[model samples]
Target: MTATGERNALDPEPIQSRLRALLDHHPDGPLPDAALRQIRTSIAPDHRSRPPSTGTLKERAQRHEAESAAARAELIESIHAVDPTPEGLLEFGRHVRRNVEPSGFASNMGAAEFAMAPGAIRAAAEHLLDTGTSLAEICIGLNLLSLAPRDGDSERIRIFIPLGRRIEGTAIKALGRIGRAGPHLAWAAERTPVYRRLGAVQAIWDLPEREFSELLYALPVKQSADLVQMFSALDSRPEGLQGDRRFARILRDAARPGALEAEPEALALAAQLWDEVRYGRCALLGFAPGEREMTTAGFQALLASPEASASVDAALAATPEDPDLVWLRMRLNRAAHSDPPLPRGLAVRVSVPRPSIATQARTHLLLDGVPLVEAHFQRGHSGRPETVLHDGRGLEALAEPRDVKIGDTGCVEECCGAFRAVISRRGGLVEWEVRDTVLKDPPTTRLTFDADQYDAEVVRAAADFDWEWPARRAARLLRERIGAESELMSRWECELAWTGSWSPDRSEMQYSFYYPKRPSGNDAYVQFSAARDVPYVPEVDDGAVMAVVDRIIADLRTTDPKSTARLSGGSREYAEALGFPWPP
Candidate 1:
């Protein structure tokens, strides 16, 4: 239609290159629809996407290898028929798998429906015996023979053997094709005692009728990599509301139920895909990739956290056998749980060693992810004990430890004292000019601790709150000190801390008082704080520790019954609570 009237030839650029170029753009962004569509196209082929002619010699070799698996299977079958020992068959299967797996893998064209008359396969197989020809040639006739059972109606046995009344259980297993045929394989899987754990895995998608394969297993395990990648991409689909959420959803979905526990071949696919899931190169399921992936792992690791093991334990949780997996989970969870960059300068407390070193720690994380303490801290111990590290290995390396000082005269004593926080972030340290000397840290005596053997230790942190005599002593010391200095008039700091399901908001606060201080070592200002951050209003007199204990009892009357109940045939004088409160 141009003025030149030559009827200019219309040329349309191929979409594949345009998509590849866009995907490879330097500032590569989350995939665009066009590129995603092209990728889908490249994966979904009619006859199996032929390898590009311009592909490298290596690529061509790979492609040829993939297509020639049937040839390998035939050669192996000849060897198998002659000697069917377990080791011999296994070796053949492994060798065949290694060579056959090299094919760039056709996308899972979806599972072959179970309806593919087994009788036809067996007949074609028998036909090969009579014809004295190649299995490849027999398969051609088989493919044609397969047509009747594959496409036509009325389903029936038609297994590998026509004359026999029942199908060979082994032949049935080899037919774990997609669609209706899957149940037959599932039944075989259930019967296979040696690999029965895999049966639970197969039952993961148990069919309603033991029939039609609507969501049949598509693509052989080796051939499913690209398909899984594509599905992972679909799951990672971004929201019009974009950001990290999209990436997160993708990985979460990729880690679905059957993924980690499928067939060896399929399990291998899941692990490979899990690696890509971790790298977070793409978005998933509206989450900012790498979201739930960390939480699941971290949660599992937390059960064996030193603090949980040593202190706040419900039941012992099992740790993963794989330490590297635990480490990966911890690092990722740490990042996923990172606080947003702060707008104000962050403040932290650090304590120096003295008689009983301790300081008031202050922090404003602005995110819920940060732990009040390193709750899962642990250290592994050496059976034969090492020379340097506390655990006889690396401190905090073998297992996490729930160890910290509260308000005790001696260090080990303080470790058992009822306190709010034990492990204070080292960065929060600061010194106030008291008089001639700097307060060693903990408000009262020098914090004595067993400095036996610890290097830059990574401990699982916890609080100690065992009450009775020591808790009584610490309360009396504070009351006697603060009551003497009522004139100082200080800041009112109240933070309701709880462990597990205690309702911090509704636990009736008895708001009590602290007495004035009498100058002990000449520090003018008196520190009027409980050994821990808690709702228990401490007594003004030495007789007062019981009042808070009484309040703990009163709340228990109606406090969610799930929180407290008599373990033994219990009486009035005894009770217990969950978790630790930090005592200064």
Candidate 2:
């Protein structure tokens, strides 16, 4: 019962009765809309209201896992104690069918545990797998085979692989576990639907390169999204498909003229393939040169078809700003103009796009006026925008001889993806080599720039901030005025810092001298804000803000003698003074 004296929705008996009543009324067809609404309303509130436990989510999860472990141990012990007879095994299968829900938690015995089981028990499991009519018994048998994989059981498991969705995944897993299942797994990958072929593709990675290449070519292309997982699996292999002529031939065939028609799915796949080559996935760079040009030409041929082009244009007209569609349109425009291929020169330039409500100030890197990062990396999935160097020391940092993050997923929290490069100077040349990356199988990208040209470009980019927002201007002026080793810095124990405003229309220019080691709830820093309309020129507005900061800090010091002492003292004294009240 709930606190309101109403029946708890989680009470399975009542919920089951309600479901039975509904099913009886609509026995052979879909339920009416009203019936569906009734069903939802009956259970949604209680499910929402019930917290798993009166503890933090982490604590609750830990407790549940511990309980599950204890339960599994007890069940395993009980199974070990069961009599080792044909009758006993049959009774155990019956017990499982009666008590176990197909989707519910159950103890799965591992290889070592099954090895310790009586020989009679293992024989019974195989017998159940061979002839059991019950889905539960078959699923149990499949799991046992996978854990204690036997070469002899491979053929038996293969029979169940194509049976149905109910046990197909389990059967596939078991077959993959047995020795020498690569050929069978590859066959399955070719026959299964694209969505269900991930496991099969992963299992066949150890196959010979020729066989793997044949498998990839034989699989039918459906939607572009379907190929992402397949390409990902290929990229994850240690040796990769580098310099394999068979794989190169496969790519060449795929890129051949008139191979891909003007269908929407084909066009999307073309774009994905182009992206794959650009990002260097699947060891694409190991292939002969000019394959990229051939692929692009193939995609362009599809675009040249009047009917296909019209369809894509109509889609864009209806949903003009869909990122993927927009990206496709951009690529088409570039292709139509025959934009010069990625420049192989030493010159570097930075391009800044106008700011908008949805996007903040971003900078794009260009080599000889051709976009570098934009042409290479994928913009992350929807809602998470592509990351680029923003207004900061990001560009200047590139000049240093260290691995620097050139781009990333547009996340300020934990990074989901990043592209990094090592910049080094050797003699008269500056080398930019891809060191670590988020790409699956990125191509080798190493470029050498004349040392003088590279240094000049870095200096030019860092100094040229004509696109700075008012907040950026304010922060820059503050940092300049309050020198790195100023008395103000020592007193406040902070450095001048600012992250530009996210909003474009209304700039809340915030400048702060932040204390690096301030305690929680201790607002021990000085902050200033400027509005969008404020004068952005450093010479015009710098003096006024600096004056205000000086006055405020002077007032704070005079009023809080103890706080000043704590700030000046060493770590031990600061620790001793933590609990006492301090002036802001």
Instruction: Give the 10-residue window scoring lowest on summed lDDT in candidate 1.
Output: 376-385
After superposing candidate 1 on the true structure, give the runs of residues whose Cα lies further than 4 Å from its correct spot.
Answer: 1-120, 123-177, 180-284, 287-321, 325-584
The Cα RMSD of model 2 versus the native structure comes to 13.8
Top-scoring candidate (lDDT): 2
Cα deviation of 178, candidate 1, in Å: 3.6
Evaluated at residue 451, the lDDT of candidate 1 is 25
Q: Which pairs clash in model 2?
A: 280-443
Model 2 alpha-carbon miss at residue 13, Å: 16
Q: In terms of TM-score, which candidate is strongest?
A: 2
The alpha-carbon lDDT assigned to residue 145 of candidate 2 equals 60
